[model samples]
Target: MTAVSPHKKEPYERMSEPMATLSAFAAMVKKEFIIQLRYPVEFVASFAQIFLIVVVLTLAGLMFAPDGVQSESSSDVTGLVVYGFVLFIYLSDTLWSVGFNVRREQKQGTLEQLYLSPASKFAALASRVALTLLWTGLLSIGAAVLMSSMLGELPFHNGPLALYILLMTLSGTFGTGFAFAALTLRIKEAANTAVNLLQFGFMVFCAPFFPFAALPEPMLWIAKAIPLSYGVDAFRSTLMGYPNGFPELAPIGVELGIVTLFGVAMPLLGFWLYRKAENQARRRGSLSEY
Candidate 1:
């Protein structure tokens, strides 16, 4: 009788981890939604905040327009400002949600239990970020519609391109948040203050509501170095048909190239830092120490 070959595991059969990760992600998202639903007033407040920002900025733009002529240039500027603010909402919401989530869990005494679970940490964080982005995206679209109607023109020039660029922008923003989350994991008590300071710094230095050219030379250089600056300019170019805020700094295409590069690089770096922090925390038995 011929000897039967022993049953062998196939190389491609290692999908259990990914399947487990997916299951964990779905569960996390469901839990987040349920918790958020319990706080409906929070959602209402979030929506109101975006709406108020757009309305105030739209009125300011109209009020400052020379002689209320609503020249095409002025309209384009208004569109750019509105789009920038919408992007700001997305960035700030995602960053704070991801960065502070761990601290929130720690404060609730759930961080240790979370680490005890077999689910991937990255998967849990990704699900939280996804949920945050989904709600923020919805609010942003509503704000965009309100702003566009107020300005009497739609801001988005290329729907498909704008969507693609928005994804890239979100990816880079997520990376930044992921890195911040790692820092929060290491420094739980300071998480809220750190996130708030970072948000304010981004608002001032990133020039989300104005052209990069309008910044002073030193500040302009600093803004150009930031990925969000490219994202804001790319959004305006794609959504408002405006020239890049700094053509002398880089063409729109090159600016997007930089954004895409950060979109790829930052996550990898953040994940590495996250893993290192996690291991260090485990070694020190400090994951629950807050």
Candidate 2:
């Protein structure tokens, strides 16, 4: 160490704010919680929407059942249908809300500020997704309880199995969410309308109401290919005691693994694309125009 140059230091000696990433993430998550808590209407509305849908579906099932279809079995189907419907709503809400949220932040200029910060884009997105997932999970559980009480039957047969299925389904849903969110970074016009309109197509093409077999040939194939289709199918398997129909859990595991991998990787890729788009917008002095 021939009189180590005074200006020279070890590679690891840079003066960095340790734990800055974690602190930023924690702060972002906390901010999200505070904002969500402030809007009690959103909290109430989520449950209300799910409750109303369950009622409509149950009443319709009761009205439409064949003369010999057992009332008890119809209730099970109703519960499964309600679960699927609520899950779709919860997942779509997470994705579309992120789109609207990014739009609002872009309009208000906080989005650019977030981009300028040292916090990683992935970190920022994770915080938002965490908040969204929390709301989705909570509302889903609450809706399940309410539906069980109303239907006078619990859909879950195996607690652990149901939980595992739910987690896998959520993994696939989050992958879809990442893809949706990535679309918002550059194409900001008609964002709200886009989310709303897309919801219908999503529900249909994903086959949430009925099995893919009931869809037309082309749509049936398309539905089977979608991530949401797997989520809905797996959910039904768990809730309807039809796990054997889902290929004995191995395919479920594989799909879940693939979805989980995509879930982690897609958001990072989305963040990269989002930042590139944002930077291009700022370079053209059009950041606030959206």
Query: CA lDDT, every prediction?
Result: 0.79, 0.66
lDDT of 2 at 215: 76
**Candidate 2: regions farther than 4 A off:** 1-18, 66-76, 243-265
**Model 1: ten consecutive residues of lowest lDDT:** 67-76
Query: For candidate 1, lDDT tens digit of each residue in 1-290?
Result: 98766886565655588898998899999998999999999879978988887778777767766655353335566576777887788788877888888778877889889889888889878988988788988887798788777776755578787777778888888888888888988988888888888888788777777776778898888887888788777877777765544333567789779878877888888778878887888899887777
Off by over 4 Å in 1: 1-15, 67-73, 244-248
State the displacement of the C-alpha of residue 261, model 2, in Å, after optimal TM-score superposition. Answer: 4.9
What lDDT does candidate 1 reach at residue 28?
Answer: 94
lDDT of 1 at 56: 80
| Residue 92 alpha-carbon offset, candidate 1, angstroms | 0.6
Q: Report per-prediction Cα RMSD to one decimal.
A: 5.5, 5.4
